[model samples]
Target: MNKNFTLFNVLPLVIGWIGIKYGINWLTIIATTVIVSRSIMSLILSAKLHSSLSHLSETVRSRYRAVLRNPQLTFSVAIINMISLALWGQEESLIILAIATGAYFSVRHQLLRKT
Candidate 1:
């Protein structure tokens, strides 16, 4: 994984961990709020993009389809990893969480840049 992406994924977790240690609910709440907001924004943007596809020329449509491929595939992996985290032991869950967060950041960053 790229260092910057990894850093982006890990930094929030680290802050949340500290909050947990200190019994600070606001930090955890803030993190959850950010994640939820980002997810909502992504959903809106994706819906708009898909709706606009019909308006593009055939060549552009083909190029866009090639570039976009299937974003749902990425979301599927993230969902599976999350489910695994719930089923895993503490150490294993942490690893799964890290991987999932990395994937989330990577996809979110890539899509943001494209838009």
Candidate 2:
């Protein structure tokens, strides 16, 4: 199994535990898990992409690099999570939004810095 994948699955259990301890609803817990998991995965993949760029053809490398640099996927996921939280009447939606935005920028910065 991929180390990143294993890490992705395992790290969220901590979030789940925190949620349970705090008595947070399942939906919010799930959303938090998704956001955290995606953020970690994106960063891991970005690092891997940076390391492997030399092995890829020019065209493929450029395209992959561009995709990694884009923040649209992160933004979309944040928007979806925000909308879902709002619809569910969760007050912590804003907190989630902040976290998602932070993650998005952090990942973008990492990719930009590496490349």
Best by lDDT: 2
lDDT at residue 102 of model 2 (Cα atoms): 68
Compose the digit string of candidate 1's lDDT tens values, residues 2-61: 674344334445555566678786775554444444445545655565556446676766
lDDT of 2 by residue, 36-69 (tens): 5565565566566556645767676556558657
Model 1, total clashes: 0
TM-scores of the candidates in the order shown: 0.45, 0.41
Q: List runs of model 1 lying over 4 Å from the truth.
A: 1-10, 57-77, 80-115
Whole-model Cα lDDT per candidate?
A: 0.50, 0.56
- What lDDT would candidate 2 get against the real structure? 0.56
For model 1 the local lDDT of residue 53 reads 47
How far is 105's C-alpha from truth in model 1 (Å)? 15
Q: Give residue 14's error in model 1 in angstroms.
A: 3.6
